[model samples]
Target: MFKRVTVLLGLNADAVADHAKASATVVKILRTLTTTVQGLAELRNQLGLGHGRAAPSPALTRHARLALNSTVTVTEFVIDTWQDRIDRGKLPPCSQ
Candidate 1:
């Protein structure tokens, strides 16, 4: 998902693993966003929300909440950046 977002922004890399070869700004954002997404993924797994584990996973309410917030922040940043590009005509408008 993060890769898709970056690609839409015109970054060449397709995954976080390729961050090492990306430009400085791309690498920086990818590193930070990658950490946030990883934390969110871990929380989802531990909470048994997406993982195919049995019910009654260990509860970490506070930590999970924080992770969810972080996830939203990161997601919004990518979305807003994309929208800004469109508004500024840096990116083409969506076709009907």
Candidate 2:
């Protein structure tokens, strides 16, 4: 789904992330965030309690904490970038 984010924004996913990291276009690189979001999806699908798994989750408490923190990081980056675009008059005018 995070990969789709770049697409929705009319960007090539891998290219934009690579460029962001290499060019320092923004304050920080976002390539690893793709991996983090993907990993979280896999972990939740395979071992999450909601999946009705028979075995106990191999994910430790620390791992879950890290996932939450990573999610927050991604969320903040997205919001900040979105606001930056609005500030720069890059995004289309809001209907409202």
Candidate 3:
């Protein structure tokens, strides 16, 4: 999911990788962000609501808050990147 979104937003590392103009920091940050989200997805699959649990969830309020905050940060970053691409005309106008 992260890769797909990254590609759609023109944030794919391949676009910038192997290019002298690329920012190493940006690529590293994106990779880290994707890994963090992937970790969150695994946490959700294991302890989050929806999957049948024989007992109570092990998650605490702090855990939920962390996940929520991480989600918001990731979402905002992706949206900002996408808008930046559109603004620079690297991407075409979004059609609803």
Candidate 4:
């Protein structure tokens, strides 16, 4: 007999830990994308600010650069791992 459960319970027929890991991976990618875009926007805003009015603080520039770099690295690592797993037949194609 089939049973129904609320999504709130987060039940899955597939390996629960694998499902969770996959979800976390996707979330991390999305978060990194959002952060990278936001960082770039902030950097642009700092550039647009006139030099006469206080210069873009070095700290802000440094922080933005660091965030952008981290996001890029994280995204690349996730993508590579996902692709490698799929290529090696370790993971099935994800479907919605």
Q: Which residues of candidate 2, in runs, are more than 4 Å off?
A: 9-28, 52-58, 93-96
lDDT of 2 by residue, 10-56 (tens): 33333355465654533234556777788888878876877567888
What residue pairs are clashing in model 3?
Answer: none
Give, for candidate 1, the lowest lDDT window spanning 10 residues.
Answer: 11-20
Model 3 scores worst on lDDT over the 10 consecutive residues at 12-21
| TM-score of candidate 4 on Cα atoms, chains taken together | 0.39
Looking at model 1, the pairs that clash are none
Q: How well does each candidate superpose onto the true structure, as a TM-score? A: 0.65, 0.66, 0.77, 0.39
Error of 1 at 96 (Å): 5.7
List all candidate RMSDs to the true structure.
5.9, 4.8, 3.4, 11.2
- What would the per-residue lDDT of candidate 3 be over residues 1-96, giving only the tens digit for each residue? 887888788675444546745666677878888998999999998998667767777999999999999999999998888888889887887899
User: What does the lDDT come to for candidate 3?
Assistant: 0.83
Candidate 4 local lDDT, 4-67, one digit each (tens): 1112112222223557888677666555555565666666567545456576555566776776
Alpha-carbon lDDT, every model: 0.71, 0.68, 0.83, 0.54
lDDT-better candidate, 2 vs 4: 2
- Candidate 2: Cα lDDT at 39: 84
Order of candidates by lDDT, top first? 3, 1, 2, 4
Over 4 Å off in model 3, which ranges? 12-22, 52-55
